[model samples]
Target chain A: MRFKNVFSIIGPPMVGPSSSHTAGAVRIGRVARQLLGTIPNKAAIKLYGSFAETYQGHGTDLALAAGLLDYDTDDARIRHSLEDAWSSGMEISFSLGVGHVPHPNTARVALWAGERYAEIVGASIGGGNIMIHEMNGFDVQCTGEFPTLVLLHGDFPGVLSGITHVLSEDGVNIGYMDVDRKARNGEAMTVIEADTKITAATQLKIQQLPHMIKSSIIDLTLRS
Target chain B: MKYRFLHELAAAGQQQAKTISQIMLEEEIAESGQTEEHIFGQMADYYQIMKDAVNKGLTTNTQSKSGLTGGDAQRVQAFSANHEPSSGEPASTAMAYALAVSEVNASMGRIIATPTAGSCGIIPGVFVSAQERFGWSDEHMVRGLFCAGAIGYVIANNSFISGAEGGCQAEVGSAIGMAAGAMVELRGGTVDQAVHAVGLALKNSLGLICDPVGGLVEIPCIVRNGFGAVTALAAADMALAGVRSIIPSDEVINVMLEVGSAMPSKHRETAQGGLAQTPTGRKIMENLKKRK
Candidate 1:
């Protein structure tokens, strides 16, 4: 493993009653927004276990809603996210999810803006760090710890090769990669954790590749 | 060897005959691919943020929406300022500052989650109070943070730092231990003394549950930060006086993990038991829900 940045352990300045509940929820919502490609017109936040039990007190609800608007973790506006959502006409709802969740601190944010939609499932794994375990019903893994590219494509040969070729040509180093499919030769999602920023041109090039259905870039290069 | 475990960090410091802060700074430089000046500069920003949080918390009287908390930080500050604290000015001041930060966190004010938000108070509490007494330089606080971060990293990767996963022992417990070690380093104690301070501070926090009344970070959490700061001071003082811990630092961490694992789910951050289940606690929860 590459060196774990000491800053990862030291701090992430944020508004909080709880890091796992508030800060982590903000990151998940931010990723959901990124995947959606626009400020969400509507969002359905389903929380499980501890999140469901104590989200209100921890400000987890407000944090998630604020995050969908790309609010930073320390934003004071987070406290009024629900009201803001209402006033902004961003329809939002929260529900107690009683189903499979990998961790106790789990949230499934379903979001949409116009024609674009994204379903993001993430776990707040303590200390405000999070792992986006699932996206759009596809079992993929990403932490948003680094710049990441999530590509939806047809599961076939050359899809991964073609994407990596573009990244390689652009001088982007792949830190980690995972490809998940529903079945042997079906739709797939590929997650690439990038060591360097995936330039706008690089992302466009990857999206333009044959068999690429959708591509989303989640930038964690800058620690917010 | 990598700085993944407490033993590795200790061994690296021993082999190079460097202080814990020195080893940590070198490791940070290697991991971040940045210059030491940059890291120090970033630390300065964090220091300023911490100071800002303390100051904001001390002055803010705005109550949280939940109506359960706010204003205790100011009360503590007032008490310390108006009278002579038998524990002395420095420790009392630290407690006040720590309470202020924790109060800030409880009220959803911006704060640096040092390791985690639930335990955010102890670091600033100790550092600011120590600064009030000794007036250490900005560089010294940065070094102390490096030392503190190193200790927290070991525990976080090896065991857990989430209250929901390992209870308050992992949350506040880790913060207090980290603060104690950092206090030692800032005061010019050796690496071994810093480790000893961590051990002393951690041992007593073991088996502590994470039960906040009404599932809020107020109630016990804010006041507990004051005690945690005091504990760090005591441990640092003992280590500086050449006190030795019978249990090694790594073993103490293991002990804390064991205790957290043995605890029931209700005892964690679920808020289903402990003080959270008391009659008054239940009333508070009901009132909060009614307001919502």
Candidate 2:
């Protein structure tokens, strides 16, 4: 089921030495960038398991850096992404994690830009596919395979209904949805993977809803 | 709209009176909710990347960042141009092209991962070289990619395509089977022949381990891609010549999953056993560590 389309098997033109290590790393970084809604001025990246062991040999570091710069997977500039980051005044650091990881190719990336910040934990499962498991300390699952909506809102009654109403009005069917909160009636996060791309107008409508703090659409298909 | 197994795909192709590639294209359109023109355009772009990588690797003598591998593809191309190879022009040229794309991959150049980057070279090698030999247009090769995609989809869902999970059999073996099956279709063979080619190619690669020296995608990995292209050509010819696999393609894929699961971790891209632990491999690893 993961390999839904023919292009998933035969395509995804990418700059690579290894899809799982390099291209998948690029996608993880790209997803983090999209979540943050802009290139961060500072980033902290943590590599775990196999990624830490063979990151240099596989160009995982460079690919991750390039992805944070909003470069596509096929961008040849990945080879010199570190230099690019330095010249662009992007403060980035990489560290190896020593404990258990959910997957062999796990990475925890935290980004900060002015007053905005985001944290993501994701894994490059195989064949350039990724599963993002955590965002801002919330346990959620997103694959970046579809147009996804991530919303931060107050944990209160009618918030979920308000969001789904916007999507339904736009004719965007929700293929999957995950809702998580730190505590009852506190801040909460909603992750929605939609069957069709949500229009910018629909996203704005959700963003203006009561108790909605932030809304961002991670549309990976557009880059492809 | 979806066919999970080779038999199902073949039956769908037969019932609908379409080629496997056509069936795959239709399925992709339905599942992705994209227009046929858009999907075909994306695949066409990937094919162009494949051709570009082959040309770049063959033309340049670029070394990887680790300096462990470089220029072997050009050397092979020179050898093929100067002397008659025992394997004939088709196989030899395909081997050279395969080496080229793999070398490009090692250098972190742009390329399409047919299934995975470790086995990125096989489909381009077979398709580009065959295009040169048969005088086919890029459009024809794009359709062949759809055929390859169909086979890879089935293998990926049924077995595995990552070296860490299933060793090189799942990576290079899947590529070879995909290329063999696609080549059969491109050569105007029946859907039955294409399925047989998948079985024949995969049967030859059942227990192949994924022991890359120093865990980099160089050394044995690149050379294996070269050999894989030749095997794909031979398997396609065999299937086209009325040879049928006694074991069905779907059964072969299941067996690959079973064998890959049974394989030891050391032989599954861990760089612990096989050639990765050789004296020279250890020396290379040590040197790389010192540099870091």
My TM-score estimates for the predictions, one after another, are 0.95, 0.95
| Count of backbone collisions in candidate 1 | 0
Question: Where in model 2 is the C-alpha error above 4 Å?
Answer: A222-224
Alpha-carbon shift of residue A206 in model 1 (angstroms): 1.6
- B-chain TM-score for every candidate: 0.96, 0.99
Candidate 1 lDDT tens digits, B1-292? 1577766776777889987778878877875567999987887788888888889888877376677778877887788889988888788888988988988888788888888899999999999878878978877887888889889888887778888888998989999999998998888887888888888889989999999888888878888898899999999999999997889888999888888888897888888999999999988888888886
Deviation in Å, model 1, residue A179 alpha carbon: 1.7
Which segments of model 1 are wrong by more than 4 Å? A1-3, A220-224
CA lDDT of B131 in candidate 2? 96
The best candidate by lDDT is: 2
When summed lDDT is taken over every stretch of 10 residues in candidate 1 chain A, the lowest stretch is: A1-10
